[model samples]
Target: MTAPHVESDQVRTLFSRAMSEMYRAEVPQYGTLVELVDDTNRETLQRHNELRASLERSGDLDRLGVERHGAIRLGSAEELFNSRRVFAVMGMYPVGYYDLSVANVPVHATAFRPIADEALRRNPFRVFTSLLRLELIEDEALRSEAARILAARRIFTPRALELVGIFETEGGLTRQQAEEFVHEALETFRWHGDAKVSLDVYQKLHDAHRLIADVVSFKGPHINHLTPRTLDIDAVQAAMPKRGVTPKAVIEGPPRRNCAILLRQTSFKALDEPIIFTQANAGTHTARFGEIEQRGVALTPKGRALYDKLLGSVRRHVGAEGIGPNAGDYGAELAERFKAFPDDWAELRAQGLAFFRYSATPAGIEASKRRALPSTVDGLIAGGFLHADPIVYEDFLPVSAAGIFQSNLGTDEQQNYTGRSNRAAFEAALGAEVHDEFAMYAQAEQTSLEQALVRLGSPHVARKAIA
Candidate 1:
């Protein structure tokens, strides 16, 4: 008898859980953050029945606790290319390009995640992977040295490469093979205290940029941070101090809203961990941290444009300073500025400001059979024939990500880099094209509407003109 194939979703779920466990063990404070997020989510669900109900109706309730996203920075293209193959085993693909260089950070990134509705519902684990741009380094000698060191070291284990090849050729892994794959893949993200470079070289790279040293000195691209989703980021941010976790001064992204939009994120400061250099010298490195994110609806391009305009207005009012002495005032200004954006779900959909998944309600199914059924989407929704649930944004914002990095790395870590974007080079390194997140959101919304229509009745016959 042929062995039953384990779904990629299941493998992803297993690997995500294992990674959380490993990370929690490595960073005990992360466990506390997780518990706090869990408590916050529970409290939010209790306090907000409508939010809870909407989540239940949309299939987001089950995966809420399991959802997580981790980040890692790779020094070379070879490591990034191999990482794509490893992540494929878990059904994660690169989506959206983030050019941190524009934000004065030297990395360009993509979020590796599951795109399909079913795959996401199963386990929406993601990894924000970044490829270091050595060419951006001003010092040619330092750049060459960094490249040579990165080339000399192999981030992946021999077994992991073997398994990636096996999975690629065979299309899937058996249960045993998958278990082994998880173990080996985990090694790539595991922290190594022993640095590959001497203290002088590390200092040189560190002088260039802390992140550059972080990417080059390490044996592998250690998972820098793992983020757990929270229902209320403000609550968590307020409560982090009480829990002994020091959250960044201001929450990154849009201010709190009745109907959230895009992603709001905050994190405790990166920990200063001790490491041994190649010469048996000891020093400290700062990278790993615990992060919490509260996701909101995926906005359409128009919505995003409005959001960007309003955010810029807030910054203009508040100045270049972010989240410090003026954080409280900045937040108030943000809330005031965002008043221009719609807070109601119906309004958002009507304005084409956000993407939403449409589902046939019991009333809708009953109404579809009637001759007087509404034709337009808005009409059907108004007539209680359809329910539109906001499609949760499953990606990261470049500005928010850069802000988080800056907050952790330090306020002074900012450096001027002229190269704004290199998506072609990033893709060449990643070994595949990054999927368009906006298109993905649009397709999902369309698919959900089509499915709802089909469920109500035949496409041609169901509700003479349903959107």
Candidate 2:
């Protein structure tokens, strides 16, 4: 008899649940963050009945509770190449390249996530994985030393590699093998409070860049932070203090909007955990933290360019440091500058600035069975026969990402490595090209529109055939 097998979706759901449990135990504050976000999401849904109905119609309501995104920093190309294979076993493929060099952080990244709508609705778990850029280090000797240390470490367990190879060879894993894979894979992201290098080496790397020290000193890329989705980030940001969690001074990404766009993020400070260095040296490191995210509609390329321009205009006045003293009014300036961008969904869709999933309403289905319905999407909507919901952005924002990293890594002043986006180099290191996020969003919208039209029975085509 054939062995019983579990699908990748089941494996991913199991892994994500296990990962959350481990992180909650390791960082107690994260559990608190989860509770706060859950409460906030509940209240937001309760207060906005329309929003609740929209979420339900689009199959997002069930996902809201299980959605999560985590981050990890790796030290070498070898690590990244293998990490991709490991994630593939969990039904995750990388989408989008994020270069943090512009923000002066010495790393480039991607988000490993499931692309299919059904897979996402099951559990939208993703990992924002970054690889360190040793070339960005000005100190030649320190860079070499960091590289040598990173080469000497194996981030993944022996069994995890074996299982990945097995899955690749057979194209699936048996139930027992799948369970083993999840257990072994979870080890790679587990916290290790011991440093592989000496305190002296760590200090030199830290002096060069806090993030550099973080990537090079650890045995493995521990999941630094796990973010839970929130309906109202502002509510969580305010309530964090009351719950003894200190939020970042400002939230990352666009200001609060009537219809949220792209991604908005905020996190509490990193925890200062003591580490045992080589030969019994005792010191501290701050890397792991709790984060909350609010993801809105994915945008078109035109929408993104406008967002980038407005954000650039505001960030230009702030200090080069992650959070500048001049940035006291950063939030105010951001809101003011973004006024040029429209806030309403109809205007956004009309202007071709955002992506939405179109679907036939119950009335539309009933009317279609009786007689031909309006052929155009606009007409269908006008007649209350169709509806659209903004398809949530499923990727990261590079600037918001860098800001999140710097905020938690305890870096204040950072050099601006402007005009240094090297997607070619990053892709070469990862062994595959990242997916174009805008194209993905556009395709999703078009597919939904076509499917909705099919459900309406293509009235224009039908009338022509009748004549």
Weakest lDDT window of 10 consecutive positions for candidate 2:
458-467
- Any runs in candidate 2 off by more than 4 Å, and if so which? 319-322, 459-467
Q: Give TM-scores for every candidate, taking all chains together and pairing residue i with residue i.
A: 0.96, 0.97
lDDT of 1: 0.88
Model 1, span 1-467: residue lDDT tens: 75666788988988999999999999999999999999999999999998998898889999999999999999889988988988999999999999988667899999999999989988999999999999889999999999999999888889988988888888888898888989988998998899999999999999999889999998999898889999999999999999888888789899898999999999999998999999899999998999999999999988989998998787667743364445558878988888889999988987889999888889878776775566676677888877899999999987788888888876556577736699999999988999999999988888788888777763543332212
Each prediction's number of clashing residue pairs = 1, 0
Candidate 2 accuracy as TM-score: 0.97
Q: Write the per-residue lDDT of candidate 2 for residues 259-325, one digit (tens) a residue.
A: 9999999999899999999989999999999999999998888888899998999989764324777
Question: What TM-score would candidate 1 get against the native?
Answer: 0.96
